[model samples]
Target: MKFDVLRAHQGDKWYGVGDTRDAREVEVQHLVDRGVLRKAAPDVLNKAAPPVQNKAVSAPKNKASK
Candidate 1:
């Protein structure tokens, strides 16, 4: 199951608040019950990263030409 961590926690790995993680249903339930993790919304898991912009570069002039 996918969960959004509500508080800092450490199991096999460390999980911080606002971190999203995939965990076994049983483990997720245990954390949810403890108020440390909650099921993540589908949209949250599917959020896309912002696109990178490509910039144009000019060729450097030869110093010997000066």
Candidate 2:
């Protein structure tokens, strides 16, 4: 899920708006609803990138058994 980074607090644990994850969207929206965090525009996300997809890793071969 793409949780586009909108606004960050303290440089980490960044909370933003417009998330692909529904749960996270609700969480952030809840915070906004409660007035703890303000709504963030998606302009920052437009300037940033999406997370990279996972790839398969091969295991190393051992030659000792030969």
On TM-score, the leading prediction is 1
lDDT of 2 by residue, 1-66 (tens): 134443343223445444322235555665456544554446575566777877877565867644
| Candidates' C-alpha lDDT | 0.84, 0.47
Least well predicted 10-residue stretch by lDDT in candidate 2: 1-10
The C-alpha TM-scores of every prediction are 0.61, 0.26
Give candidate 1's TM-score.
0.61
lDDT of 1 by residue, 5-30 (tens): 89998977998899988989786787
TM-score of 2: 0.26
